[model samples]
Target: MPKDPANNICQTHIFEGIYNKYSKGLHDFLYYKYGVQTNPKDKTQEAFIKLWDNCKNVTLAKAKSFLFTVANNMVLNEIKHQKVVLNYQKKPQRTYTNETPEFLLEETQFLEKYKIALANLSEEQRVAFLLNKVEGKKHSDIAEQLGVTNKVVEYRIYTAFSKLKAELENFNIK
Candidate 1:
């Protein structure tokens, strides 16, 4: 079928039409590739946004390639950044067969301090961080529950790390 020339990437209605047509597939793609750690919906939106941004250059026929490429790139970016978001996920405690009693005592004390440090974070940051690390939620899922975008969730997680890093700068958890 010939694409409607009017439905170029620059046209809002056309762009939305493409979004409506492919959003689910794009989402499924992200979900399958990134699992629950990332948000496919956000990536889909980002891909569409990029299409629109370069609308004049994009055609309805070429839309699929453009969207997939953009979405894939976004997913790759997320995978690359996973390490930074993981600062919130530390081992609560690790036991050794020949550990010293003094080491155990100090470990317990450090955990308490860590908890206190977590408690001090802004609610938004704390929630996002914990949901990602403790609950093992994807930014996409957390964003849906909180009625925010995945990027917002990412920011919250990032800020949480910044705050925790500053607060717990002195201690090195083992």
Candidate 2:
């Protein structure tokens, strides 16, 4: 280990620490956002390599953001280069003889309001809330993935629920 601050520049130990702390999160983020089409693992590694090549200039506070930005840009560039047409089909409506038309209409309206409420959340709040609720991630897992503390994750989820609850107060949640 280099004891001198000046000598620690791009040191092996420093690089390893950065890689260890961020690799899994970066990989998971890329995979979640781009799916298999972006070759997320490869793109994640490319981001790390880019970071390593510029290690001297990257501070610890900015490293994570830098990695994500590079990965996002790479995926965006690849997307622009390829013309893709998705074959999308809407799902058939549910039919239940036991339920009244009014009930079905209410349910559909509730779902629409819920989606609108979710969409209105700030990006960070939405990400935290979705990772915890939709993805079934524990607070610790979300914190690790977000490079934040568990308390921050808790706060985010709590606030998200508060906002959603307030937004949907007119609906019957039962």
Candidate 3:
């Protein structure tokens, strides 16, 4: 049977109520997941607008999960778009000063090696590492945002760290 417009309105109202209660948390979740470069606020707003538009199709009990899933998809899309933009941009040559030749050379080499090590990580491991180490997200939160179990998140983070540490073993950063 076709649903009534009035019923849709009621569902939307309920979704809005749920959104009002959870928007801040959702925004924080996105920010932690994607970081500042991806513009979490705009993405969060867009996600909720999508939710409001599809409110009739989403049940109250499922609204939270739906909002998170929608928001994550938006973030992933933004990341992919940004990656394309970055790949097309011209690479600038870095110039080094001679005042501290030893320090500068070491720093440059370390950065190059670090980049290579990071590139070696799997996408999930890389994301987990950045979210935990750089963004300071708890394992539970990372798991929730990524739709994975906490144990899995922990394993990814550990694997990333192990790879980085192994790759960077020769570097004396101190």
Candidate 4:
């Protein structure tokens, strides 16, 4: 079918208006969902561009949902790609000349074991653990930041800890 230039221009205006109104909210939503900043911005920008490209088919009332769906899918795809890259990356071990050979071998083994254990965790558990432990975010803060209930955040943390503890039980490194 032939395209309508006037309709396209009108749709572009509508999409621009929507983007101006909701860009901040969309960015925040993406950040909270992904626990990252740069990717969230990229996803938000991509979502807006998608909306602009498909504006003629979308109504104003459904624009927010469409943007969110696009952003969520983008984040998921990025995460999956990152996981694949991480899995294929070679592990880099640090060498210390001062350390005894036995100590160095044990340390390398322990590090590799820990990495394998961590990789076994569920995505939500891993994310919760990183946000709470690595990022030093409180459960309540993480809950609010992630748009979940505080109790759910606590549960996720507990689940993550239990799984990690079970996986590392043989190491006795605490």
Candidate 5:
């Protein structure tokens, strides 16, 4: 049965009338504003779908304005998304080195052994060594912080280095 055009557009006949009336105009507006690359025809269908979904709330009188507004906003969002994609494509991509798997395995093994060797050191030796080497502090500065003599700080760091070198000697660190 045919629905009255002045009544609610929730009726199929009235909704079809709205689609037939506005679909072409909305498509043309989107195409002229955003170009063919943005797919104006698809956006036109989507706007109609939105209108149909919200048919209960939208009056027949306001249907044309609703479709145009939805279609225009959809095209604008697509254009903004395309701009972001283009900007991402314009940025330089990072290049990776082609290190051998065997070399990487050896490096990983060396690091594990190094951590174990560091853990094996006496607390005094580990603290002094890390403060001197990792923290880049002088022997006198380490001695002042640890409340020890400069010579004692020097001895601990030397012992820690000797132990680490002996323990990590078997693994090839690349």
Candidate 6:
């Protein structure tokens, strides 16, 4: 049927005619492509609203094309947004510790003092001490790495511990 040229889609009756003609097809298109989960009915209504908003730019001949295009794009955008939300939900949540501020400050201060104490050690003593304590090596293994006797390795480690104990005595470091 030939539409009246005088009454554009911006008019209530003409707009209603366009809605009646294309709303169902557009809704079905979105439903078939993305399913009911994507809210095809709402998207179809939104598309018609957009058409009305820009009715001056859209002709009766182009109204069907405009509705389908707008509805399809809206559904695709919503699907992409849902995927992002799902991916975010799947990520591992970060765990936060409930340490008090004073305790955290004390821990930080102790670490700083410990670093200074380690720095104060003689190179030979530091090497043997770290290889044994930090790296979990035995005195015999440390002696082999340092090309020294086990007794020498033991002496260096013992001196390192004694110095560290004295340096960190105020903090009660073991």
Candidate 4 Cα outliers beyond 4 Å, as residue runs: 1-10, 90-174
Expressed as tens digits, the lDDT of each residue in 143-173 for candidate 3 is 9999999999999988888889888966332
> What are the lDDT scores of the predictions, listed in order?
0.83, 0.83, 0.82, 0.79, 0.87, 0.88
User: Which is superior by lDDT, 1 or 6?
Assistant: 6
**After superposition on all CA atoms, how large is the RMSD of candidate 4?**
17.6
What are the per-residue Cα lDDT tens digits for candidate 6 across 15-84?
Answer: 9988888888888998999899989999999999999999888888888999888988998888899899
Of candidates 5 and 2, the better by lDDT: 5
Candidate 3 lDDT score relative to the true structure: 0.82
Ranking by TM-score: 5, 6, 3, 1, 4, 2
Tens digit per residue, CA lDDT, model 5, 1-174 = 554556889989888888888888899998898789989999999999999999988888789999999988988888799899999999998776688889999889878888888899999999998898888999999999999999999899888888877887763321
Using lDDT as the measure, the top candidate is 6
Query: 1-174 in candidate 1: lDDT tens per residue?
Result: 554677656777877788899999988988998786777878888888888788888787889988999999888887777766675466356555688899889889878988999999988999999999889989999999999999999999888887877887574321
Instruction: Give the least accurate 10-residue stretch of model 5, judged by summed lDDT.
Output: 165-174
Pairs that clash in candidate 1: none
Better of 3 and 4 by lDDT: 3
Of the candidates numbered 3 and 6, which has the greater TM-score value? 6
Alpha carbon deviation, residue 30, candidate 6 (Å) = 1.3
Candidate 2: count the clashes.
0
Instruction: Assess every candidate by TM-score.
Output: 0.45, 0.43, 0.45, 0.44, 0.53, 0.53
